[model samples]
Target: MLNPPIPLNEMDRLLSLSDLDLDYAAHQDSFKDLTKLAAKVAGTEMSLVNLIDSYTQWTISTHNLELEQMPREDSVCQYVLMGDGSFEVEDLSADERFKDKFYVTGGPELRYYYGIPLNVNEHNIGALCVVDKTKAKELNPEKIELLKIIAGEIVNRLKYIKVIEELKSNLSEAKQTQKKVAHDIRGPLSGIIGLAQLISAQGEDNQMDEILEFMSLIHKSGRSILDLADEILSADNKKDKKTPELKGNEFNLLVFKDKLDKLYTPQALNKQIKFTVNTSLASETIPFSKNKLLQIAGNLISNAIKFTPVGGHVIVDLNLITIDEVQHVLQMRVTDSGVGLDEKGIATILGGTASSTNGTGGENGYGFGLVLVKHLIDSLKGTLNITSIPGAGATFEVNLPQ
Candidate 1:
């Protein structure tokens, strides 16, 4: 026999629901009680909660039935799903559609079949059914109504399971976010505390000019820590409230360059690493989110400084390139002469596996920075490419539409 045709929209909805993947047969105890109640209420000897897939009809819960699954072609529930109301066959042997079916003509000789479709997510994917061996009389109005009520209960349980699963997934993601925040702030906080201690040790014994310089370094380190905290808190708040659409704001390239220089030049000098920034559009202003851009650039530069060995170099280049001769793309590239990544390390970092590694300067990192950078780039509708050769260097290129 041919398979029954399913409506396109119904099929789409069935595929989207998480309940379809649930192995209801494995946890059949609750449903087994439901089937028993259904049978007792409807005055039937056998009851089943049947789920129909592409080619099989699975009995998730059954009372007085031996089989767990049968071919979908032999299923009465398939016909039940064709209607919004219950399907009732008072005498299966007298019905033309089921008379020749093996279950009717062969063993058990089912004579009565009644099924109410179970609707979930506005789609009927299964049925609550009752069957009997002896010819049975037509169901009364009260019994039919009770069957429908039980089917509705099954649908509610499916929805409840879906909600619980979603909550669990969200909680897991939130915990990971907290871990990432702690990881990203560690290096900057260490710098702040270390610089503050240096300023305290130099009290009164240092020359006035030297004292002023050390105090400036301490202030800069403290601001870096604050900026990192602010970025994390802002991201969490947006997520908690459901992220709103971002709007473009005026971005000054020269101001951005100055911030980058102030932020990393001292750290580079301390480590004896060459740090340079080259921008072709220094005086130009662009429409972009300045804070988001700063977050991405800051994380990249910080990671580069941490990984690059002494005597190595880190370079940042910003320019505009024409694409298809009709649009300009803003290109920002960060290149570093660091201990470059192997394939395994690259996969672990970019895939958000939270792998931690010690940097060239013994700086500890949890690998969340690159994951955040990738997410930010995607939100901007941009592309990021990383090129690396082990023991040589690594380069990260980002392109955003302008």
Candidate 2:
């Protein structure tokens, strides 16, 4: 069998090097401890922790290259620039892998080199490369294993930096978005509410009907403002909840069916949509968070009210399915008659992406509602399932352990 040649372009890309990467590439720029660690592992006097950018290599940890960054073309660790498993040159001057690679042999009497790529993702920033002045030494399995482990430690630190970068970006965006949405909605909402109050105080007349219409508009606008505020607040308070104390538990969906009815009543009234809350499960409750149950129900019902066309219907139901002869699961569904979604929309909501779409009254949000739904289900150690056709409404099923 012939071997397939790796594309040179893709092969050279190594560890994750974000604009926020803190790794200094110069051997002189690295801390003394790291330089010492590198030197010790390579049994060399010039071990270096190198990070390569497009034009130059930075020395992060090094024993010999103190205070000076080598050029990209002259970097022996440039081989580490590849995200491939690892690069080792037993004798930099003799090995075919890098013998003609002038950077490895031309500088510092370097006769040997070995490097491990520090890839955090597709971003290949650089390598933990080592060099020596003596004859190439054979490294056994144990020695190679230890080198890889040290490389992992370096990568772990890099990953923490990367995550902090991502979180900061997400946080900033969340706050700004909440601010703009809140500001835009608040002015009109307050005006409508104030005017409604003034009309209610007017002297009574056949104007009662006109006043009532104003009152209804005010109420709907007020609800919209409230919902917007809730969403904004929720984003700002992204839950940093300590892991909940987990224990054996159960939630009763059958008995909870009636409670679901009470909750969906307002939604039905507002949308003019008929909703049925029914149960088929023998065991209404499953082992899960009692409070999370309410949150799930509230979100689903609220969403139905927002999307279901006027005069359409929504049904909430639960059923028991035997997983095995001895085990059963409580299944609950919230089905609504409304604008149906395409396959991509379903995937976004179901595949852990926040998909937003405009609601019945031109209320805009991600078409994806199942993000929260899926998260809540996971928190309860349960499962979520969804099915929808483009024209038919969506059905969401929450399966809980009994």
- RMSD (Cα, Å) for all candidates, in order, is 23.6, 23.9
149-202: candidate 1 lDDT, tens digit per residue: 999998777676656656665676676587577667877677776777676667
Q: In angstroms, what RMSD does candidate 1 have relative to the true structure?
A: 23.6
lDDT of 1 at 396: 85
For each candidate, what is the lDDT?
A: 0.71, 0.61
| TM-score of model 1 vs. true structure | 0.46
Per residue, candidate 2 scores C-alpha lDDT tens digits across 285-321 of 4333333565566557667656778888888877777
Who wins the lDDT comparison? 1
Model 1: ten consecutive residues of lowest lDDT: 243-252
- Looking at model 1, the pairs that clash are none
TM-score of each: 0.46, 0.36
Off by over 4 Å in 2: 1-37, 40-46, 53-55, 60-68, 79-112, 119-125, 132-140, 153-163, 196-402
Global CA lDDT of candidate 1, please? 0.71
